[model samples]
Target chain A: MTSTSTAAVHALAALPQPYLLFLGDTTEAGFAKTAIGLHDWAPEVCVAEWSLPGCPISTGLPTMTPAQARAAGARAMVIGVANGGGVISATWLPALVEALEQGLDLVSGMHQQLGDIPELAAAAERSGRQLINVRVPPRGIPVGNGRKRSGKRVLTVGTDCALGKKYTALALARGLRGIGVDADFRASGQTGILIAGSGIPMDAVVADFSAGAAELLSPDAAEDHWDVIEGQGSLFHPAYAGVSLGLLHGSQPDVFVVCHQPGRQHVLGYPDYPLPSIEDVIDLTVRLGRRTNPAIRCVGVSLNTHGMTEQDAQAACAEISARLGLPTADPMRQDGRFNRLLEACIA
Target chain B: MTSTSTAAVHALAALPQPYLLFLGDTTEAGFAKTAIGLHDWAPEVCVAEWSLPGCPISTGLPTMTPAQARAAGARAMVIGVANGGGVISATWLPALVEALEQGLDLVSGMHQQLGDIPELAAAAERSGRQLINVRVPPRGIPVGNGRKRSGKRVLTVGTDCALGKKYTALALARGLRGIGVDADFRASGQTGILIAGSGIPMDAVVADFSAGAAELLSPDAAEDHWDVIEGQGSLFHPAYAGVSLGLLHGSQPDVFVVCHQPGRQHVLGYPDYPLPSIEDVIDLTVRLGRRTNPAIRCVGVSLNTHGMTEQDAQAACAEISARLGLPTADPMRQDGRFNRLLEACIA
Candidate 1:
């Protein structure tokens, strides 16, 4: 097996058995996508499925009950539900509680949990179910492979449906490769607060990849599977962006950068649109860091211009760095100073 | 007027007209309270009610047609719904669109956009009604106040809610007061993104506040009302923090500080909690600002601890600042260096 594969296997092998479960419902496509991603990272992990009972005509799929899920010997469970309000009802809570009471793990394929289901959060806390939240992009976005080998160490990038998080992840990974760091992008399910890559089953390969990140960035910790990078374009999506800071906290990244586009969705009523200048971002970062965790040593800033010209993108980056009083370098063309700074801190 | 009344008037007079709205179901307490606040703020601003014909409730209230609201010169409108979910029926959208189409202003008591009513965000955008998003905190908290004033300057503090925004806001406000800054706490509604001021009509206040903020802070152009300092919270809540930011972007401020806290709600299914550090918040702030406007200059950092002693708080603050590379100072005590910094930036 490749080193990445071996590492993922090792991480999965080290994990306690029966600690994870996978829950499936009508929106199996979305669920399967995320499950597949999780499975890819940790192949040896066993997942239990409990389909929702009384399949509504809308979805027309059988669902498993809490008892069935329990019978599957799942200590942890991942649930994927169909979209639409009717499907998320009080009945689901009981099943969820059952799993949690039995000390089973819990993860969700719910897109953006904050306003979507307040009860779910309350229930999880009450039942002590370890819930991992996943937000599938608006649909039809490919997953990104974070493989980098070059210039500035593009350490982190996030993706969600249309937010171009995957693209950014890919770009960052590729950019890092161009700069000489072996970087790879991995999706941590939902990329916001309340839920992130925390609960889904990570295969051995994925677990090892997570371990590598933990070791390289935060070696003192046993393993860091919760550090979810901020997804792109989320800064502007209503109810999704501001609270993302909460998710970032859940993920525990050394440095977090929010990628944004200005004037693209200006009329959408998204709060973070007309993206703040780089300086503003840096200033806010420092302030937020001071309040959250002071131990964070370094923060790096990058820009995604949403298909803007290279000059425009560069100008934006330069202007942002100048405003924030931080070092700035081009990701495409290697900047040794910037890379060295990032490598020294993150590595 | 009583001191409370007088304060209310001063606050109201400080706001602009033709930019306010009321929201909530007619029977809901929020509707009545908001109406009372509006009456206190701008007695002359006409209140037009729109109700579905089939809805038999609240028959005595003054109801208006879409055209009547337009003709009555209603620049803002408020809707009272039963709960956060009531805003999403087909009946509500037409009237809302009518108001927006006819250029009526908007506000709501529910703490989240009526458009968030089910699939309304997508529908509204598709229908050409530019929906400004806002988020209110969840059910457990009260409103928030503005910064504390010490002589002529102000001090502000922030925190991630799970790590402690409420406590931080309260503590920082108290800290500012201790230092002789007449400080007060402000709630960023439910989502902790926007400041939830009591007894203030948002629409009426938005224009004046935005203008004032612009004149005081940027002055070059109109600021994003959703991005103002006090308007920093979640966008999903009905009272979006972005609206506050937008309104206050260029308005008054001698200093700005964002509080950061550790610990977060665990993601479902993750084996461990990904608690974000102060550094993560700092990085987030920087990125958030960059994604919007980068003009905000952070001058202070407050470390929020859950009921820690003064000594512990100070130690936490010191450690956090040293690690984040930001200067640290106690807002409770006056210092020439800090004073100099504030004076130079605000001036």
Candidate 2:
């Protein structure tokens, strides 16, 4: 089952009393739709649209005076500020803080982009509110019909900032969807998915690292602290090239396709900073499959057209595959070699 | 002479009409001292103490209403807001705008690091006030008069988020000051600095890259545009790495010492992802130096402790130096190897 389907099933079984409040402006139509769609399973779900006097959609709700909004009782609040630069005004902070004090299960400060409003975020944190970020997908990605299904397992990639990562992720998602897979993309980071759902708490680990955990721990201590690993470095850092290997360990996968863009090609190594080749990818896959369940299958690679042309991207994929001895294909092409590789892996 | 001294001398020689305003909870004594310092140079230099309401210091000067503060001004205005989560309020935006509309020469938004207040900054920008950030150094950097430098060198790192960059720049300035270089960091983009005292009308370059610039340029052209470059990546992404490199290049520093905690080592390769090693650093330095100016001199490196022990730090420094064929010395030690390397470079 797809993650979204699984989530829906779980929601139906539990009958969650999901209460979402749309604070500030009304730019987050996608989130509203998502919440409203779940209303059938969560009959008790309440979505209050709160706004100031001049705000467009000020009806069917109490005036967005902080006190009135606090009294409305929302388990989760998604605050979407108007586009441009109004989100960071001092006038918007008090109301935000008041909502946090009233107690909220989850509070997402939904701005088109967070880099534009650091003060608002800092204020939300000071008020003891965990801010969740919901980002729009990139322009190139075809927004799939929400009601359609393709019976293929989906993989999602998320990052903290919305604009750039969203573009790459949406493109990747669309590519996957084009190949008969249903991919659900979301923003993930301190102010997004990690903050919203029940995942490994990276913040606590970060706090432990900041509080001198490295020095205090004995050499023989079990590596229960995931923060140390994250802090030491990730696949993105040469200091932690081994991190990707570590993260992939003990995982069962039929096929592994790494997605990246030319601008960010260095992450997986390219040109001068080359790591193992396509052969390494196949070798790792086979080794991992044997180590885990022996049912593990194939390896494929996809390149993001972040700032590269189709020709350059295809060339890069070929080079990567040739070096590693793994199967290679163009992700953007519907019936391209990439889809063939994926089919081979799953078959 | 120090950069600030050079700047002060240049300012005095040019005799620009200095309209200065001090914000924050600064004491009457502190205000008096600052006022006296500037009074010696320009008789028209105005000092408004926003810390106290109705203080004679702010009496007749055009008072900025909250609404005006939020509007964008053509000229720059300095501000000092109370740190510690102090709200500047949306109401204050108009007054800032009014100040800009009044044909002020410059606006410096000074504030204590009370806490994170992004709204105040947005209001200042909306008013078109040039927001220059100022802050006290961090704890590890020795403050007060034991050091020769009174304030740090104000190097404007990035302009997208002045307050955030200010926080990091201030920390960096303090780190530099601790090592006896009187650094006063400023948070202005290259455009801001070019127009700071130039009196030239600013024209923002917003090219249609894919249409206009992309056809004639290389693949990196899309990544070079500030908007696209800024939008695409995280502080840890490779695209951002170019931005940081650009910032470093614009600063034209004698030496660039990147300060990073061991935990956040991901930032070392940051903006490009997969942090480059000592050899990569050497290569990058050579590439940047050759591209910018053949006469540019290369200097040794320094590492911020970030709470790492002296032994571990020494080992890391040594490893880095051995890889780069550069000498490694203790940054903290009075007679350390790094100190000697810095001394030679400065000489």
Where is model 2 more than 4 Å wrong at Cα? A1-182, A185-299, A302-322, A331-336, A343-347, B1-19, B24-77, B84-255, B260-298, B301-347
If scored against the real structure, what TM-score would every candidate get? 0.33, 0.33
lDDT tens readout by residue for model 1, B209-328: 322322232222222111122333221111222332322322234445555543334322222324344454444444343333444446556444556666775676668667755655
Q: How do the residues B1-347 of candidate 2 rate in per-residue lDDT, one tens digit apiece?
A: 11112222112022223444434334454443333333322235443323335344432345443224223322234443333443344444554444545544233322232123454344444544333322211111110111111111122222122112322333334444556664333323222222122110001101001111111111111211111011111112211222232233223333333222233434332232233343444444444423222334434444444467778877877775676556554444434665555444434
lDDT of 2 by residue, A65-111 (tens): 44454456555454533445324345655555555565543333232
Score candidate 1 by lDDT: 0.38
| Residue A88 displacement (Å), model 1 | 4.6
